[model samples]
Target: MMYTVIDIETTGQGNKITEIAIFKFDGEKVIDEFTSLVNPETYIPEYITALTGIDNSMVAEAPTFREIASSILEITKDCVFVAHNVNFDYNIIRNEFKAIGLEFTRKKLCTIRLSRKLIPGHRSYSLGKLCAALNIPIEGRHRARGDAQATVTLFQRIIDTDNSEKVFAEFLRRTSKEATLPPHLPSDIFNGIPNAPGVYYFKNKKGKIIYIGKAKDLKKRVLGHFYDKTDKELNLCRETADIDYELSGSELIALLMEDAGIKQHYPEYNVASKRNPRAYGIFTYQDRMGINHLAYNILKNAPSPFITFFNITDCRTYLEKICVQFELCPKYCHLQEGVQQCSHYKIHTCRGVCINKESVKNYNLRVEQAISFTSEISSNKIIKKPGRHPDEEGFVLVKNGIYLGFGFVENTEQIINTEDLEHFLIRQKDNVDIQRILKRQLITS
Candidate 1:
């Protein structure tokens, strides 16, 4: 197949393509290579200069991207445009072409996703990162020409590595509908999913929430179930009458609803992390006077509606690891509070809070530090994030000292105003699931 592997370097915030390189390949060998530094018509940020080593001064006299549009079109004719993070680069080039009243049409593929699919279990699949991990020579990590060259080499290796059967199947998957899939389902079951990051609901024949899921790539995850070899999924697909979904605008919102929906409607097919007795877990500790800290005794009974963990073991394991790292006494943390400094203090892992060496004041402070997802428990604050659509706003809430849910607001002033703000936000359940979502969203942000 004819291919043009392209790479681009852009002005950071403005996202204006500053340089572009294209390598034309006819299956086996490269026919030609083209590289150009285009005047971004904006100030280059310092970080971009440090990373790409391409300065604004260098592109000052170079031709603008508009000047090379025809050349690019000629080179990429009858070719699939391929790149690392192909969508970002392809969109930038397409947008630039559109600016000059030219319509750019090309099939596109992302090598980052391809590499992850083709070669699994690498720590990272970033173009430069994968190059380093695989010992691929990358002299110019961020520049257009250099990255383009690296991608061509990487694509060459991918073709060599891909199994004939799997590659053929994947190729067919992209090009046509699957013939092996159940005839009862629509040919466009795959096409039904959207690429946006959001929550997806799978409703069964009874109009019940059979399954709720979240994905950074919603389309990929939903389609994956159809292709999944799991026995349960196969059974679910056989019985599914129709599908319904709510676009959450964010995975955080999706996850919050996924958990809530699962609990609210215990579908026959779904089981993991259901809000049964084992829904949440907490680590508890006793003070010097033998008082069981209500903080430690977290379960369905615990008053603060903060949901933290899937299992007790997971909670213990995570807290133990954190305690050792931060020198937090396992004793004070309700993990191992006993007579003398815990085993960790003797082993030099802890600062001897268990042995009364560090003041309980300091030890208690450390214990509090190790806690999380309780920001909703501690701080009464509203969270703001980039909206899903250009016209909307996105948010997760902690309102009136409760873990309110996520929603959209139209104006910035509503979020900025404190006392009247809670009235305007899309209110959701202050349940443990929402609390978990809020906590995770904060940590990620």
Candidate 2:
């Protein structure tokens, strides 16, 4: 089969191609070559220029990708595109073609994955390191022609390796994910991911967790990352080398597990939940007239809060519900500020506590009742869910309205109260995010 070993130098920020090189081989010998420095029409970052030695001035007089597009299409036609990290080159080219209103598609192979399969035990599979170890000299190093030429040599060596024909056939199969997976990730590892509810962790080369996600179908969700064409997903996949997962038996537990894992590892890619969310607290106090008043403030300012919420809107919403339920004045509850008496638009349940139509003694009694209701809603509870396997049961434990953790127990075990679950509990810290997760579960249950 004919193959075109290719490489491209890109402007790091926008990934615009600055240079490209292609070497066409007919399995036995090189028959054609194409190399060019293309004006990217964008700024090249200093770091990229320093690495590739391809600066703005060097490509000023060179042809743009648009000018050479047809040449590239002609030379690479009917050839299996091959590269050190094939997806990076292939996707960048495809995106460039897309920008110009053309579709670019080609069957591709990654030299890195092939090397791992045929020539195992290498410390690293990066083109530079692997080539150096094999004593294959790279004349231009970061330059497109040099890297592409080195990749060609590596590809030839991979072809000549024992059992290469069978390996190639397997990789070329329509159903094989070898070309779709991250260059650093092994197919076996990807295949091992079960189609079950779980929390998955994406780790870098050093095994450091970089992203965490919860999924009802772990395999499908993980595979979605590979198919996503967004810049963030591309960058994430490029850095990911390994994956680790913990089965949670159900989606609810998977969410809880995912939250705990992200908080613990503080993975770089998990941006939303990393920050400590500011909390708003609802509190109660008595005015000079001995009328009980409910108010909300930032958690730090509201000492001994009756109930807490992650945002001011939710805090206000909860207070409104309690105010209407107990017939308390909205003015006293801080829902309406700078008003002599409660005149809330949606809430007309006030018993004239603000207007003095109701006695302070009677109003205080209902305020106390509201406080009791709040405590009842936030009372300790347990949520039961399906287990990881048959004959097993899973449960989430909450005490005093705070999430303690989740765990599994055998169906044969006769468990009674929350105390019986402490033995199997996987303790986790309570946070606004976790609270939100559990609140949804409570609402749906």
Candidate 3:
């Protein structure tokens, strides 16, 4: 197998390559080599010169990257590029090619990753540190050729071990060409994406939303779609033509917007964001005995639910927890069935409402408390969260338990009254998902 071990020294801040080295090997030995100081055509920082000792005068008459670019490509062609921290070196080279209006891509292997997997017990993977530990002498530490030679030696040592073949195979698999933009989407779309929390809309050629999503970091999440191999992810990448976003200033607002946007647009590719199919709900009823009972009903014919749940298991789990907390009867809640007192009553966990040992008024009082606990969460109030800026605060407004939407308030005192908060809030439509998310948040908070 052929491998080209490579390394580069840059101008430090903007990362223009000032020097680069490549050693082409054919498994057993170095077959070819290239090393040069390149005229970055830009000023090299004083600190970079101190670290690399390659100053302005040294590279003044050296060939520019454009002059040597073709030679670098030709030597490394069809060779698996190997380096310590391959991503840093590879991206630097690829981007240099890109600036010259040429696209360059190559398979790469990182010795740092290989050493961790194969050697396993190294205290450090830094080139100088590792070479010192391995007793591999390296001269001219920061220069490109010296570092590239050290990496080549390290690669040889790793390839001689018993796990060499497996390790190399793993490297080959990981270093495959990275995921790229889909044919329908231009690369410039990513240039405009911000790293802030927001909701992103993926649209097709006709300007229709194909998917809607929210992320704590918008750029990272959208880029993740490009790299993901899942069928749904691939479909989103393939169908997307343009990307749009709204900064929510906070994750809660982003989530709220995501929920409403999905429902509003009903995007074709967003299956997970579509309305829930489960009709499971938690409800209340009064039996003939004038005892109130909480029950799990599947689309149960009640006028309204105490609160909707996604499934019977969730509904039952919630009811059980509420009953346990309030010391209500398992039988009264329909969690247990029997002619005599329920099991919870025997254990003293139940307040004997099932057997009428506890007065109807007292037991029903706790039931009312549990019902009110959930019902009141839907009540009007300002839900505060961290804002985009340190001096600002974000809030979600829920009036009488119906979500009014969200907004940012700069003056925290403005949130003390609903009338003032209304001036800030941007209204959002009410959807079951939004309601459910808010319900969960209120319960947890």
TM-score quality measure for candidate 3: 0.53
Please give, for residues 269-382, the per-residue lDDT of candidate 1 as tens digits. 877653543544454455565423323344666555343554455555555555565666555555655545456433356665555566667666655555543434436666
Off by over 4 Å in 3: 1-196, 203-209, 217-220, 239-242, 249-251, 263-266, 272-276, 287-290, 337-349, 352-357, 411-413
What pairs collide in candidate 2? none
TM-score of each: 0.46, 0.81, 0.53
Steric overlap count per candidate: 4, 0, 3
Higher-TM-score candidate among 1 and 2?
2
| Candidate 1 Cα errors over 4 Å, as ranges | 1-175, 180-182, 203-211, 260-268, 271-275, 279-310, 317-327, 334-381, 390-393, 410-414, 418-420, 430-445
Candidate 2 segments exceeding 4 Å error: 272-374
How well is each residue in 389-437 modelled by candidate 2, as lDDT tens digits? 9889999988888789999999998888778889999998988788877
Report the alpha-carbon TM-score of model 1 versus the true structure: 0.46
- Count steric clashes of candidate 2: 0
Q: Per-model C-alpha lDDT, please?
A: 0.67, 0.89, 0.80
Per-residue lDDT, model 1, residue 337, is 53
Residue 298 displacement (Å), model 2: 10
Candidate 3 lDDT (Cα, 0 to 1): 0.80
lDDT (Cα, tens digit) per residue for candidate 3, span 1-445: 8999999999876678999999998878999999999999999999999999999999999999999999998999999888886666777788789889988878877777677667768666678989999999888899999999988899999888887897677547743322244434544676688999999999986889989999999988888887674546655665677899998888888999888888788898877744554766677788888888887777755446878765566667677778887888888787877656677533347867776678898988999999997777657667888887778888899997789999887855544578888988888888777776775665446
